[model samples]
Target: MTTSRLEDLDEANLSPAQKVIYDQILSGPRGIVEGPLRVWLKSPKLADKAQALGAFCRYDTNLPPRLSELAIITTGAVWRAGFEWAVHAPIAIKAGVSPQIAEAIRLGQEPQFEAEDEAAVYAFSRELHENRGVSDATYQRCVAALGEEVTVELVGILGYYTFISMTINAFHVPLPAGASDPFPAK
Candidate 1:
């Protein structure tokens, strides 16, 4: 299910557990997908951990804003979280990411990033998500582009998003209406 649909949601009521999880998400500046889905997760502690981990990964990590945002929204797109993609895409764009780059991530295609640096950033996000971590070669490429501290941040971003995406998925949270799930029945 996509995160854009509201029709299938448990909007009117939430379990006490779900409420706590929802509260944590809503307290943030912008958290589009986390609230409604927390109810479906049926595990408040896990939900909170996901949210906190996401925040720390996105902001507290040493990654530059643009790189972290790219990693996050790409993760969202891969996971088919309409809400996550919708919310974070613009954040990345505003943080200096090009529209082409954002479009590529949304479409599940690799962007033709002319500059080696930009290509490295995109590849790092892709490889990290694909391999669940950077390979030795990919890590070296990432370090060449981003250096060690930022490389660590990039990996953390990927890991955190993976956790959130899986959480959003396993609970079968309802997607907003008209939103497409990138992954559908085989």
Candidate 2:
């Protein structure tokens, strides 16, 4: 069994501030409070701001869901955040990322891509996480394939998911019921 570092807060007993943000999250594009947002709800102020930025990064970004999900899973893979990976990997695939690509990321291996845009996104996310900076060539390639606006949103997606990964990993956020852990013991 997974041991969460934080107690799950009951929605009914929430403080007024927590209730406001909780209600906002419920009514927003997310429609449910789960994963790191639940953990963030412990501090209503943090939850309020973070959830708003998360909503934009997730639902309103210039990058398509396919590429944004790719960056998200890549961050999850790098952080070994099981909750992040388990949640976003399927979304990544459903959004048009190849299963082979997702599998490669799951195993921390380079993926062979069938599309130039996918290759650019994978390279950008992988390099950003692994090297902590993107090389000029990789940045140029990503910008060329995805454009400056999309590339900026890609960076935003990466940064936001990095936050999510840290929350999930640091707080020991449990995966959904019946979901297997995404990463094997390393």
Indicate which candidate wins on lDDT. 2
User: Mind giving the per-residue lDDT tens digits that candidate 2 earns over 1-186?
Assistant: 269999999988999999999999999998989999999999999999999999999999888899889889989999999998888999999999889999999999989998899899989998888899999999999999999999998998999999999999889899987889988685
Off by over 4 Å in 2: none
Worst 10 residues of 1 by lDDT: 2-11
| Model 2 lDDT at residue 70 | 89
lDDT of 1: 0.69
Candidate 1 lDDT, 1-186, residue by residue in tens: 534323333645767877776776777744554433454345667767767776688768876777778778878877876556755777889987888888887888878776566667677778766777667887788889888887777777877776666655665555445555444554
TM-score of model number 2: 0.97
- Candidate 1 stretches with Cα past 4 Å from truth are 2-21, 31-41, 114-117, 176-186
What TM-scores do the predictions have? 0.73, 0.97
Distance (Å) between predicted and true CA of 111, model 1?
0.6
**What lDDT score belongs to each candidate, Candidate 1 first?**
0.69, 0.92
